[model samples]
Target: MAGQNLTTSIIIPANNEAIWISACLEAVLASERLEQAEILVVANGCTDNTVDIAERYVKLAEAKKWSMRVFDLQIGDKLHALNVGDRHATGDVRIYLDADVQVSNRVLHQIERALDREEAGWASGKLRMAAASRVSRAYGRFWSRVPFMAKSVPGSGLFAVNKAGRERWGDFPNIISDDMYVRLLFKPRERYGVPGTYVWPIAEGWRNLIKVRRRQNKGVEQIAERYGHLLKNEDKGAFDRKQIASVALAYPIGFFVYATVSLIVRFTKDQSGEAWSRGR
Candidate 1:
């Protein structure tokens, strides 16, 4: 299967990501391995130029005789958009990429090679925060080390799957982190993480970081509530204790320390400026 002609469908789900969509599409178009693949951009409930950007790429794909499709859906969630895209795909392999991330041809080829293996059901790539700020870089580094942190998996933004796997999983679960849900459906060995596959930097601000943490907590709560019965035979006490300590104790402590220091520094800078102004 090394040199086999594989039909890969790349599905990009966008909400209001007009600013980065063009760049993402450009990278996809430039990938030699993907030249014969179908690129589908599912613009769901986007109240911006996302649709227009996708349309432009569709025209470019057509002019180059590359297969492309742009589907407009009213779904407001990422999972819904992905399901819509997957339904329209006509490839033996389905590749999921975000609208804001850019992937290199080398990385794409690596993923393709991994999928060429008969035993590979799902293939993910190493996620590198491209040109991220200091805080984002730190977060990415910390996340990359956690084995249970599904977000670090390539399935978060860039993932490739065989048609059989997609059919078995049906569609992405309607949740904040649908990638994690999909990963849980498979045995750990069924998911392969290929190195050198990366995504572009995430635009992270302090507020955005807080929002993401909160959303993650909510997703965790949902998962626990829905799957708590699965842990009935395990040591439920230890599991609960660890979960509580991590979420209730550790995270809040870190958040408070960081916020307190940031606020103190801001206040100190403001006072220094006032003193200088008064002296002048």
Candidate 2:
């Protein structure tokens, strides 16, 4: 593990992400000092030109001596798409990236180097929330300052692990929160956060915010019920009343939006049996 040579496999599970895939790929292709890597865009159940758009990058990737493959599937399951990427990935390091996320130029390279040691460790870039609408901007500002997000490797849209670190799991399972499931695999001490940042987009407005919040709650509940043992690795600090008061006083708009979303999601009926979409 120590002094090991590494090539990273960046897996992007995209579902009708024609709008964002190009930006994501553009950011990735602009990496600063990555020696070698492959980009696997798993275009699952895409009805648009996602596959065609991704395939256009093949030559660009070739110019860098890297390979870019788009695995077009007829099914629209993220977990299944991820497992498919794993099967065809040839790199020693594995980086899971969401289609909507745009990484800083050095993110993949930094994470790969951080996980290059022999020890079993997982790594991710710093999370930066991007919001288009006013309400979402407020919410994102509040969220970006929360204790858990500021204190830990909250890999919402991006995470990477070396070969030794990946031995902890087999194929990606059918789960509500794939990110949560993978993150809880390692102890806090084993999670590494590099200096690079990735912009994770937020939902547009109120209705979408509630939808995403509810789905996130469901994901956490699913883990708590089925993979309860992984809870030991959970280090999310409690959302104390003092912090709440401080946020409410300093940023009423953001605090109100964030609180309203949580309240609505709290009263909603469980929709775990139904299909849940993350964003609009």
Candidate 3:
């Protein structure tokens, strides 16, 4: 709270995240750096107790002298919820955090410091999957090395930016990859990926992973359709070809591998059952 004048607003966009809201809110409140920051929980088309959990946080914010507000939208898109929450923000700096991610005080401090610097429009950090499956670990490692490839600013699982920059870029676009759209709005130098700051979320299962990748592919296609001219000629062509090829090849290969492994496991289990019966 040393910089009381520089209030930050933490915007959380959630849908059907009742089980995770309490932990997320607690982490935000517990962050010493964010103690003075405003917390806005935007529940979009939640069919669970997400709203109730948010209300509890509001009460905590009141008692602790921190600002908190809950915005309810009947729609189910993340970008729409973000835009709705922005209207109620009273902070000079806006931070986005996903409902399921946990951020530390030290990282929050780093985010504020990064944004406080002149000419810095946005700041984000590494994302670590809390549950470290082999696939999740590999995905994180790959993304960590290729920062530019993560065009979407990442759903505030943990990111912060200046109010001025947010205004310049306007609100999150109504698209699956709104984060990427926001990143594209700014020059590469205006954004910073701080080293120490990080968020840990649950590893997405295979089913959800495929669904997300499909959505991402669709988003990429939309981006190409809308801003194809902005990309370098060769890059645009390569991107289009890659998208088609990935859709055609990746899923089938994955499915085949999964099926083979599953069949092997089932066969082994069945054999074990028969062997035990014969032994008895």
Candidate 4:
């Protein structure tokens, strides 16, 4: 498919993300090169001014000749918002973006070129964490060196798939790790890591960091228990013990912080409200 002919649908599921949604929309709108696109911000179960702020951008999006919609729902479930957004998205290339993450203007074009290949099933750009604190930056350095992190396409905060790739995995299951599920659906050969980077904020503060890590561990456990077969095709390289040692040796404090969080989460039990209150 020609890059210009491909339409992109960017779906952002937001819940009380009023502080971040406007900037998220702005970064996307700056892409400037898309021939046709629709930006859907599903502001569900928002108690703050998320919807009001998002609604303020509909006119701006229209002014730029881009189709944009902000759906306000009474409930605040991420899965519910994603399912709703998917139904209304009409573009051939569907991008699932987190309200807190920001992508470069060339990201959509990169995805277009990657998906132009018939064999490309799902794709995502490289993830770069914007951690301001020294502790968080050290942790990010260690986290980025893990074997799988360096090798395969890490499709955590932002990812996209063409129509054919979307058909491989239909509606997302009501699970916490929707990203992992999508990443595992296709074999390594079918996934593409396009050039460019998307900036994702690292959870700041010790409490918030642990909370996020615990939620992530819980999601991985859920995927392992329910979709073990799918993981065989994850396309990750072998775990390197030396690389782990090198990271830990160079950044002991960060490694200790990360390991402490992992250990705590290992002993924790899943709560009913985990999905809704994953972080602050």
The TM-scores of all predictions, comma-separated, are 0.74, 0.97, 0.72, 0.92
Tell me the tens digit of each residue's lDDT in model 3 across 145-242: 33333343343367677865776666666675566566555665677676544565534544334444445566767867886653331111123555
In order, the Cα lDDT scores of the candidates are 0.66, 0.90, 0.64, 0.82
- Candidate 4 ranges with C-alpha deviation above 4 Å: 1-4, 117-120, 267-280
Residue pairs with clashing backbones, model 4: none
Whole-model lDDT, candidate 2? 0.90
Of candidate 3, the 10-residue stretch with the lowest lDDT total is 271-280
Q: Give lDDT tens digits, candidate 2, residues 206-228.
A: 97898888878889999999999
What does candidate 1's lDDT look like per residue over 24-135, in tens digits?
Answer: 9998887765555889899888778788878988778887677898877786677889989988898777888988888876777667767775553777777765534556
Better of 3 and 4 by lDDT: 4
* Model 4 lDDT at residue 190: 86
Model 4 local distance difference test score:
0.82
Clash number for every model? 0, 1, 7, 0
lDDT per residue (tens digit) for residues 1-280 in model 4: 4434788899999999977887788888887577688999998899999999998899988987999999999988888999999999998888999998888888877876677644447899988877767666666776777767777788778888888888886678989899999988888888889887888887776666777777777688899999999989876676567877888898788788777767766786646354445343
Report the error of model 1 at residue 123, Å: 0.8
Query: What residue pairs are clashing in model 1?
Result: none
